[model samples]
Target: MATHLITGASSGIGAAVTRRLHTRGDTLWLLARNAGRARELAAEYPGAHTLVGDLADPGRLSWAFGHQSPPQELDSLLHIAGVVELGPIGDLTPKIWNEQLAANLVGPAELTRLLLPQLRLARGHVVFVNSGAGLNAHAQWGAYAASKHGLKALADSLRWEEKPNGLRVTTVYPGRTATPMQEKVHRQEGKEYDPALWIDPESVAQTILLTLDLPRDAEIQDVTVRPGS
Candidate 1:
């Protein structure tokens, strides 16, 4: 089992992945913005470790990782922490736009950069939990769309740089997951979104496990999981 470091470990897909890793008996390091929730999960699982930090402050990423009690000797990094800020392109405030970019795009990039030496030591993998919106586009998802697009591009470049170091990169494009983020979108869309169309969080975690378990010589370059009809 891989020793993994994941962000956004408190709930939704991050929490689901945490459970999957727990059941597999893997050591996990988790990042949560909220201390209460993080500690709650830490209490639930024996070896689950939590690091509290805000991804919105890109500069603090290195410091956050640096200050961990036990330095993360992570075999893989599942960059699962991300935020979706929505507003019409015309009215998208600069503050929200920057925060979204920092959290969803910059923070992940910086964390991977800071942790990559450790990952290289283990010949590990970096998994980007990208969104379907990252690959395509939406009408009013200005900040969210831009951040994910940046994420997709970053993953592509990292795949090339890190592949030679025995690092495997997998970008999973989850389509309209039934997480709190999706709830926000659904609320915004009102009658437009069908509840039947949202993908389950557990399914995303399962696919992540499957990707990680693939043979050393091979790689599943990408996986797109949509809700079942």
Candidate 2:
């Protein structure tokens, strides 16, 4: 069985992916923000493993990982955890910008760096669950979009840098998924929430699985998922 590590597995798309993988008997190592969250995930997924590392504090991930045992080699590392805050650029504070950046961009980068040895050993795939905001910045989306755009850049550079080492990097940009994060976005925008109008998290999870199951002779560099009409 293939072994994988994933972030943001508590709910939404991350949870969807974890469920599918765990059901099929893939060994899973899930990242949780704290001890309580780790225990919760351990109970929820039964046999899956949990790692405690707060993405908001990217600087301490190494120290945090040192305290725990991570998988020796990984088939995939899914960077799916992120935080977002919506506001006009003028009204957005350094604190808001920093929080989003730390969770969305820098945390993923640091985590990948720390796990490169294990990934290279297994020729693993790295999937970044980005957003449509990464492609276009609308009003009130400046900070979150900026972080996602940086994520795209990170994925692009990593793909090239790790090509010879046999690491595959893919970024899946999903548009307005019906997630808790989307609900929060609606609240910020002062709009009504409609789950039917957005893409389902399970659909995105399937797309991710497709990339992972593809033949080793080919790779999907980037894919975008939009809600069906």
- lDDT by residue for model 2 over 1-229, one digit each (tens)? 8999999999999999999999999999999999999999999999999999999999999999998999999999999999999999999999999999999999999999999999999999999999999999999999999999999999999999999999999999999999999999999999999999999999999999999999999999999999998
**What would the per-residue lDDT of candidate 1 be over residues 131-215, giving only the tens digit for each residue?**
9989887788878989999999999999999888989999999998878778877777774655557888999999998988888
| Per-residue lDDT value at 160 in model 1 | 96
Model 1 — which ten-residue stretch has the worst lDDT?
64-73
Checking candidate 2 for backbone clashes, the offending pairs are none
Q: Where does model 2 exceed 4 Å of error?
A: none
Query: For each candidate, how many residue pairs have backbone atoms clashing (under 3 Å)?
Result: 0, 0
Query: Considering every candidate listed, which one attains the maximal TM-score?
Result: 2
TM-score of each model, in listed order: 0.94, 0.99
Global lDDT scores for all candidate models = 0.85, 0.97
